[model samples]
Target: DAGVTQSPTHLIKTRGQQVTLRCSPKSGHDTVSWYQQALGQGPQFIFQYYEEEERQRGNFPDRFSGHQFPNYSSELNVNALLLGDSALYLCASSLGLADNEQFFGPGTRLTVL
Candidate 1:
């Protein structure tokens, strides 16, 4: 079975631009979560989606948003991007929120110039 997958292996943007990243969950996974990992830093939670609704969010601003589709795939949208937003966008998928096993994708490397 395939593991989680993300699109746009790399991206370049400028301040004030917007970007959308995609992710396909692993087989049998239903929950999707987004994270931002700055260079040399651990990931910071962006938000989580379950059952087609946003179930939980982290400290990120409203500009960061996401959607979960019926197929358990997901997309992350970032508006008014800033240089600070340059990082690896990671997607994680799990069977459920309470499940400890979460499979992660090879993150999309985003750069703001």
Candidate 2:
């Protein structure tokens, strides 16, 4: 989408490894949300960050952490990644927390080996 883009379009990691994914939000957007989509399933909310703080999180565990910079860009870090972590990671940008209109990035394909 025009408002959101992710880096390293694809990645490969092994079990027990850690990875960091990056996302740059829309020029005027102030919030970023991360999601994970496994094959044959809908995207699952991972977490949301705004104003440089994490305001909401989904069912993911603590191993999943994130940081939002002042520029509105954000990073998602997953530690001790498991095979189940293999999925498409998506980044969505919005104006505010849970905004009605969210521009989502194409997603970063992560395949765990």
Candidate 3:
């Protein structure tokens, strides 16, 4: 089965611009978690979605927003992007909210120019 699929492998935007990224979960997984990985830093938890609701969120600013659909697909939107917002956006899928096994998708590189 497909693990996960992400759109726009690479994107470039200037400050104050908005960007939206999408991710599709693997088969049979209902929980989707979004993460941001910056240069030389480990992935940071951006947010998580289960059953179409945000179950948890990280210490990100209000400019970051996202949603999960009934089909377990998710989209993340960042408004007024900053240079610091440039990072690799990724998504992980799990069977349930508490599931330990998470399969991660490839990262989508975002560059703020």
Candidate 4:
């Protein structure tokens, strides 16, 4: 079975642009979470999705949004990107909300120029 997967391993954009990143959760996993990691910094939780609904959110602006499909795949959309938005976007998958050992995909690196 395929583990968690993300598209466009790297991306570059200018301020004010919007970026959409994609993720497919690990097989049999239904919960998906997003995180942002800046240079030299640990990952910061962005939000989490389960049952096709957003269950929890992090300390991020409204520009960050996400969706979980029936198959457990997900997408992360960041609008009005700022230079500060440049970072590694990570996608994690688990069986449930209480599962602490989530499986993570290779992050998508976003660079705002």
Each model's lDDT comes to 0.96, 0.94, 0.95, 0.95
Return whichever of 1 and 4 wins on TM-score. Answer: 1
TM-score of each prediction: 0.98, 0.96, 0.98, 0.98
Worst 10 residues of 3 by lDDT: 1-10
RMSD of each: 0.5, 1.3, 0.6, 0.6
Please give, for residues 1-113, the per-residue lDDT of candidate 3 as tens digits.
Answer: 88898888999999999999999999999999999999999999999999899999999988999999889999999999999999999999999999999899997999999
TM-score of 1: 0.98
The C-alpha local distance difference test score for the whole of candidate 4 amounts to 0.95
Q: Lowest lDDT 10-mer window, candidate 4?
A: 64-73
Q: After aligning candidate 4 to the native by TM-score, how far in Å is the CA of 46 from where it should be?
A: 0.2
TM-score, cand. 3: 0.98
Question: For residue 55, what is the lDDT in candidate 2?
Answer: 92
lDDT of 4 by residue, 1-113 (tens): 99999998999999999999999999999999999999999999999999999999999999999888888899999999999999999999999999989999999999999
Best by lDDT: 1
Of the two candidates 1 and 4, the one with more favorable lDDT, higher being better, is 1
Clashes of each: 0, 0, 0, 0
CA displacement after TM-score superposition, residue 77 of candidate 2 (Å): 0.2
Off by over 4 Å in 3: none
Arrange candidates by TM-score, descending: 1, 3, 4, 2
